[model samples]
Target: MSCQPQYKGQVYIWLKNKQTCLLCGETTDTPQPICTPCESELPWLGDQCGRCALPLPMADLLCGQCATRPPAYERVLAPWAYDFPIDSLITRFKHQAKWPLGRLLGQLLALSLQHHFDEGLERPDALVPVPLTTRRLRQRGFNQASLLARWLGTVLQIPCAENLLRRVQDTPAQQVLDARARRQNLRQAFAMMADAPVRNRHLALVDDVLTTGATAQALARLLLDAGAARVDVYCLARTPKPGEPA
Candidate 1:
């Protein structure tokens, strides 16, 4: 049996046996909000840097930047490149408080990470989201990274520790600054919780995007300094270098 509902004069069919595609509003058998076509159309990351997940002409090679000055985190696992609908989706989810979009994206990311785990990627001991300063948390009403970490943790059966890392300073936003400036701005901005037990444990830092990786580098350094054995980044999208083709 199927039930059809009309909203704003548009008819949407709800099938008892199928789900709806969030992107195109079409009925699909896939359990996730996205249908197969929309899922395939997403900008999946490919042939990228082994360390930073930057898009590259070839696969499994460290980029020049990483080879010269390595980041604190061991590696990144970003499944998509920042492009097209993804950018729009993230903006809506982050800035517009569109919780449903964030939930959908988180679900998709969890599935992708699971595949990586099955294919030999080591699962981390804990998932720690990049924290927002109290000011930003108050302004935004919610931390997007923390929400993502919580959703991912629930799906993967990993512990989501919100207090593992703390943003001690309300640093300026990184989007307006160059890479060097961003790094300087974030220096000493993060600190680990005094009671958090991170020694010898592998941790994955969760974030919505990895642009220039300045924030992740800062947090990863903090985690390592606090005795974490390994720090890996698990972001939804990786932005290409400025002027580089996506």
Candidate 2:
């Protein structure tokens, strides 16, 4: 899959040298970005509820959350659990500017989609990245979610509409608050382009990670309000809540 290259100069060289795995600095060129040993360690999400993507027993497709209050997004498909080396790797990608890992994460997400075709995620009409506010984009130099969406669009043979969604207002980081606070903080945080060419479209909302599902839910609501027929989320990892099953 083609992606906008992020690393440059000596940092790029170090990334190439450390080809074993982005998570653990091992060695060797495995077909997958990660080495075989590291690959086994990736906490792949499996047997999840179809609606919430929460791990569930084989007979059930809806988790308690979905049963009580469904999400605006029809379904969520994530590759791995937010834990261990994967968590640390995402942290580096987001904070330390270890950007080459974006390509690796994109590849893993594609792999997950391909593996779980039964989840019913086909090639959507378009891929929409959970947008970044202008202020945050300027500070970060890039939106990590957009990076993943671009690569995912390439892999899925779908076009990515980066401009369709806009962060009209900057909100506090979701990581800093509880789920209820996160939802309250993000209320009206996103605004669709007035003339968005997204009506009746089936979209896959792409993000680097899914924490409490608040942001994805808010984005999905906006997309549906803007005439998107359906919205499915494709995230790199799903932060399993405490006491949730493995």
The best candidate in terms of TM-score: 1
lDDT for each residue of candidate 1 in 57-132, tens digit (9 for 90 to 100): 9987999999999999999988899998999999999999999999999999999999989999999999999999
lDDT (10s digit) by residue, model 2, range 1-246: 769787665554444454566556677467555778778878877777778677665645787888899999998988887887788888888877888887888887877776666565466888889888899999988889888888877876679998798998888888889889999999989888878887898988998888789999999998898888999999888876666644
Task: Please give the TM-score that candidate 1 achieves against the real structure.
Answer: 0.92
| Colliding pairs, model 2 | none
User: Using alpha carbons, what is the TM-score of model 2?
Assistant: 0.86
Candidate 1 — which pairs collide? none
Candidate 2 backbone overlaps, count: 0
lDDT of each: 0.93, 0.82
